[model samples]
Target chain A: MTGPDRPHSPSGDGTPAPRRSPWRPRSRQGRAGPLTYLVLIGVTVVSVFPLYWTLVAATRTNAEINSVPPPMLPGGNLMKNIDLAYDQIDLTKAILNSLIVSGSIAVGTVMFCTLAGFAFAKLRFRFNNLLFGLTLGTMMIPPSLGAIPLYMMMVELGWIDHLQAVVLPTLVSAFGVFFMRQYLVEALPNELLEAGWVDGASTFRVFRSIVLPIARPAMAVLGMLVFLQAWNDFFWPILALTANNPTVQVALNNLGQGYVPDRSVIMAGTFLTTIPVIAVFILLGRQIVGGIMQGAIKG
Target chain B: MFKARRRAGQGSAPYLFVAPFFLVFAAFGLFPILYTAWVSLHAVDLQNPNESTWVGLENYRKLFSSDFFWNALENTFTIGVISTVPQLCIALGIAHLLNYRLRGRTFFRVAMLMPYATSVAAATLVFSGLFGRDFGMINWLLGQVGVNPVDWDSGRWTSQNALSTIITWRWVGYNALIYLAGMQSVPADLYESAAIDGASRWQQFRYVTIPSLRPTILFTIVVSTIGAIQVFGEPLLFGGVSGHLGGAGRQYQTLGVLLYDEGWFNYKLGYAAAVAWTMFVIIVVAVLVNTTLARRRWRNAA
Candidate 1:
């Protein structure tokens, strides 16, 4: 990828571009005290050590985990422990179920939120502010308020033990709509939308062609957020689906809740379930953090 | 031409665009709230919901009188305060550090978020092992320091501490990132001017940064309070297998857990709905009270 046109193409001086900022809180740029580094490293270690411990315990036998001065490093029984977890619980099925549910939820939420967000952000309609305010108000209604009746409705719909019970209800999040609206209001230009109108494009056509590409970045962040929350959701899925149709979070809960719990197998299951999300974080860490911070500011 | 075309689709297109959200909300979100309110007034059993008898505030009465309900509320507040107070302070400190022109800033920022990114189930289970009575890392570490092994799962305060530790670990970074975003917006010249005045770093942080970050702090406090009131997964997993109703004596059961226990386990749908409504009322009141008090404090400080 390196070429003469590249901004950071190696100059004769052999120094890469100065990427660090000079406008941080402290005027003395690049002069962080050693204590600052030490504290940051300590925080990083504390943040990551529990997950590492999960891995360490998962790799060891239950006896090793339970013994005095438990094995702190990776052990050789990783495969055996994972196999036990897989056999005891249909771990693969849970993973597949989680993927399907979370994927549907994320995609559905993103689409619906984008459409509504575009309307509220750009399209002129009577009662627009009131409607958007209504959407915002829904965010305050705790999910716990609707739990019992929502479960009952699922049962009445004969959606019990179905992934749709978990997926469908959450497909249109209020926060998602609000987030997309805020982002699109800033990212999208009214002139571009007007240009579409002048070209005889219908609203839907304008959204499909002109707005979708521009909103892709915001949609990706919102989709990732919805996916992570859906993947990690527990209480509803636990109530909606039976053990045979468990999502990963529910499956992990079952594993952790077993009588005479096997520490190795539980840890192994935890590790397996978390790998997808951790992988997502590694890949989309910047976007996720950026989206969260943006959400806070706009919210 | 643009105005003419825009007027053409003004009749139904907007409604069509936003129909899905409203439709879904109507079906699942709005209807359920109304139904829960309706069911809260009746003696509804899970098995025979069709034949429920109207109780008419009886469930609310029973809930108010029940010791378990009050105990769960008390525990929820205790765990909420324990976890949220220190979490915000630490988050503020980390955010302050993060605002500095440090090396590998991006790496540190990303690393801090790993806790918030991890699923509650995974995080709780890992903590369970770390806080285990025997052969646990915390106990082992304490032993090295010539302290007694503390039982995290038993007793009242210790179990709450264990739960609070998990909640704090999971959320502190998230709040910190929010604070960091707020910090980045503060005019850099404020610090420069303060420095010119020879204000010490601590003094600058105390007077300048703290005052400037008031709105962000208020936002976090309201959000944390809302989140803390419904703290469920941590205690559920912390209670261990078959220990979902808090601890053995319901030592750490929150209102969220209480609703689950009453509705799912006890089949008292009516009572559970009452508990849910109570929690809703309490959250609204708490948020209002917090906002007013914080506003008053800000005025007094000024």
Candidate 2:
């Protein structure tokens, strides 16, 4: 994209885009460098190799897997495995359930977090420092620390079987608020708020109209992060929806947890579940990382 | 328009603005933990929540006396250290390599982070198949190199090895992206100037790259320490599902698994709460220490 975006380099009389030495160049000891390059490539392969293997392995049958060596390439029978997995976990219902759980969690967290972040950033108030400090301080506490009581409370409220049990408790996230506040405090201009106030605008109105529009990019990053965390969460759903309303991860866990497991079907299920999250990173990978860096730099 | 009710001396509404956070925190965050402590002081049973006795620090005493709890603590710390040190090193090194100017760097950058986007459950499942002793690829590859098969889940050290394998696979890429962000902030001009002064690559990196990445290193340490310390899924799954006690002798178990076992499996609410508090204390101390050290480093560097 960058190659075609610029027709010419400014260093010369507009000939064309500058060239490169393939993917990378090296010094005179370039031979030594490919070893380093090989190491880098090896690590990269090790990283994504499992994914490739899963894609290939999902299509093969158990007899093929249990051979002297595994199949090094893809095979047919993908449809058969998918059919088997559908009956095993009710793949359609599980996907819908996961969507509901992750979607509600993401949207709810963003709404509340944005509202609170706007208040902290644009609203004038006392005890703000102390409250924000405590908010930042809670990042230290691990989620497992409160698992037992949260479970008990959910049970007592009779919210155990509902999706709200998982969704409501997680709807308010500290990290999201912190990220949003960091963005809003800077991105929102003071003069705009002053003008709105002079025109008799309410605080909430000012925030809803002015601040939110400017903070959309950061909000996207926060929303994505929260969604991923909730999507990939294992502990909460496993405990909350152990038997009934099993999430995709829990259903996937159930497959391997059972006796006489169908490894091919499990692999197929694994491949299917990973698509949404992998797609997220593939699209917004840089922006997410950059957003994190910006927040951390300020923090 | 909400008017200021300052005649009664009531002040700011920021508390009102942030009420939802506090409410959720109090209900789910503070209340549960405080209740856990209260429950831990009493002898509560799952069958009868009403018929319980207040037994004060006895739960703590029992935990101290039990060798199973001690083994789980040891396993947690061992895996935490083993996985974190090398994981951060690899992350830092990869981030450095990634910071270099090259063609198609974005492909490698995004590709490197691909592992983290995969679900842990699926990743662990595949890793289990790979590390399986019989007909597993790792063993088969070892055989080609004239080495013998390793029973990965057979013993104590093997348990850590298996657990670390899963941890490294899941997190190494996530940390790399963060570190890549860190390495990018380091001005390229610093290195170019250092090169002009004939500073070797090793010297330039040691003086510039290492120092510049201090905050990121600290960030990773704080986060990785918290994560590894509270590791649950990989160990639990690797320990075998329904093998809730985490192996025959509680060998590979961490605090999260143990707490779950005590609370959910055995129905010992009070005892599990006590374990959770201990885990909380350990995490608190770690975060506090890292923050303090980070502040000092920032001050000295300034």
Q: Which candidate is the best by TM-score?
A: 1
Candidate 2 is graded, for docking, as: acceptable
Ten residues in sequence with the least summed lDDT for candidate 2 chain B: B1-10
Clashes of each: 0, 0
At residue B292, candidate 2 shows an lDDT of 98
Q: Clashes in model 1: which pairs?
A: none
TM-score of chain A of 1: 0.89
Say what the interface RMSD of candidate 1 is.
Answer: 4.5
Q: Write the per-residue lDDT of candidate 2 for residues A110-160, one digit (tens) a residue.
A: 887887887778676667778788888777666657777787777777777
- Candidate 1 C-alpha lDDT tens digits along A261-284: 588888999988897788879788
Clashing residue pairs in candidate 2 (N, C-alpha, C atoms within 3 angstroms): none
- The regions of model 2 sitting more than 4 angstroms off are A1-37, A86-88, B1-13, B47-52, B291-302
